[model samples]
Target: MNSNFSLPNQKSKAILERYASSMSTSNAVSFPMVISHGEGCWLTDVDGNKYLDMMAGIAVNTTGYAHPAVVKAVQEQAAKVQHLCFAVFASEPQVALAERLKKHVGQDYRVFFGNSGTEGIEAAMKLARYHTKRPYFIAFTGSFHGRSMGALSLTASVSKYRKGFGNLVPGVFHAPYPQPYKYPRTAEMVLEHLEFLFKHTTPPEEVAGIFVEPIQGEGGYIVPPAGFMQDLRSICDKHGILLVADEVQTGVGRTGQFLASEFDNVQPDIVVLAKGLASGYPISAVMFKEHISTWGAGAHGTTFGGNPVSSAAALATLDILENGAMENARVQGEYLLGRMRALQARVPQLGDVRGRGLMIGLEFVKDPVSKLEHPELRDRVQQLGLEHGLILLGAGSHAIRLAPPLVLTTEDAKYAADTLEKIILEAASH
Candidate 1:
């Protein structure tokens, strides 16, 4: 190898071209630039262009990129020892991180580590079924659990992800998520829908679990009607069905509180977490209540579930979240939402503004027909936003989802929102 050789171009466009030629196209649409670095709530492109990251790597970087504490912890852990088969020889980082998670989650809880959100869901589902001795599970529409076989079976994002994969792990039924902004239904109505499904479609007794998102993340950030979650909890209790909260995207203080369910005063039997748990580190866990802690322990495992390096990063990340990062997320998120609502007053395409904390969405719709999607306008706004040094994302079908990092300051939120408004105005004018 030549020691002094240099590459010709480092721009994002060139990198993308190479990526398209060499990588599998099924992964995802590539952004123009290959991101070189991130800090706080900003990302730097290979071309040295900086972007105010409104999406926070799809709601994964809570402490933001390269937080000093997380970096230091990872470095120290890596230098000491990195790899250990958790099943045979457990490490200190794993034990400490588990204890910390258990402390924050609840006293009567146990943790199961995995490498991603889907793995957590898989473990939770298996535990629910094994403990209850039941086969079926009740999931919700407009939900996204993960892309794995078991998790994908619960996801109802679109036919594209499920096509040709029919006859899945049978007995997964979907209930309409109580999206008040779009459905405009009361809590009572939502409960009625669930009751109807149970009575007509599937028996509640047969359902081992009722999986839900505390605040529907991929479902356009649809916050359930007040008391809807409590009602679901009651139903699950009455029917002996476990409640599994899919907090993969909304957990780790993305929703102001440590967990989104905290605001509703509702607790779940099992909670799945990922995304922001270790900042950007690949780590996830299925936190279960005490009663089902030892349900078939050897039945499930992962090779890199709780690697020491990721655990160290997670421990440091949790410290940041508990100290003051969650409060910052709450304050900045509220400020951003207020500004977005103000902008909505002027932009006719802004159909709705809804979310809690940093998990927010601005749904775009045609002026008269609210159900119709304006993806073209959404695409234009996203492109215009990038040109203005901001990044945005579209979720569900017709919403601009804003899931900025928890470390984003008030000023950063305002600037991102201002740039968004400008892009929307420019798109509307065109």
Candidate 2:
């Protein structure tokens, strides 16, 4: 903890206490540090403790916190105007951001704005169903789309998010995700299973679409096997079903590309983006191929979807990410992974290290003799990282997620990896 910072003020403490008692307890919190400000790849708490932010607000902040370019863009746009709904009159910032994203993705693309990732997911789902004229969707097990009803119905990660929320939007089916390390099923086997289900169970003609993360974010940052995405694309194409790539956490240079699908060079029919889109401002979007943007004018809309301020922030953030921040992610991400593997050699509990660019996962497993999950040891290691100066987040049932800002430097990555190794060693010894 830095010595220069003061603790949280009485006003802040009171507000937090009130929020805890009055607000819904459904909001699960992991870290306890009261974040006050963020810069680059680091965050400072009210008590003035500076921590290396490896989670990057759950893979947002691609341009890092309070970047000068984004700040200037927001300031300039705010001075002109802040709230101008796109429904009435399309603003320049929103239009520019769309064009920018379109250029990055492809020429024949259109964009729809929303306030969060779930909103974007909802829009994509609606468009898929409307365009295909089908009632069923094919999703993967251990996938996380979002938390809204439509998105929640599509999400198949955990039961807690869906518990008591039934009967959810029906016709959603979960198949095996292409996790080469964990699942014994190969891409062909999984696709064959999917084909079997579509033919025998749901009927391919009745299927609306298939949704996937280019890399599974919440489900341990699972990278699909080679040619897996291509096979899925082919499957969707053959069935005339839409392919929706949920790049919510993997987009914006988190995986060394504007969209993780770019790495495989397979274009999806629709891409859902959020988290890093507007830096810290709340904005998300569903980008669709020109042919699929068939919704009528009154079909769907949101009040704050593309507000000028958020658009400006998004535009500036995009500028920074496109320029050099993303490339940095690739270089530093490899360095971080290398260091982590070295740590793994020393700490046997750190079983697997996976993910691309800055979106990384370190899975903790019990001793090989037992081969079970070591949640107790994982908790201690995570707490030790917090006790030091790093804020590491957990993923899936037994893995730690490291999604630092793309702007993170190699030095910062080294420090975080080294600090994490020391903590894990101490915990393992205990």
TM-score of each: 0.95, 0.95
What is each predicted model's overall lDDT from 0 to 1? 0.85, 0.85
Model 2 TM-score (2 dp): 0.95
* lDDT (10s digit) by residue, model 2, range 293-398: 7889978898889888999998888888778888988988898889888888898788778878999888887874455788777778777887788888888888
| 312-387 per-residue lDDT for model 1 (tens digits) | 9999999998899999889988998899899888987887888899999888777735546777787788778777
Q: Please state the error at residue 259 of candidate 1 in Å.
A: 0.6
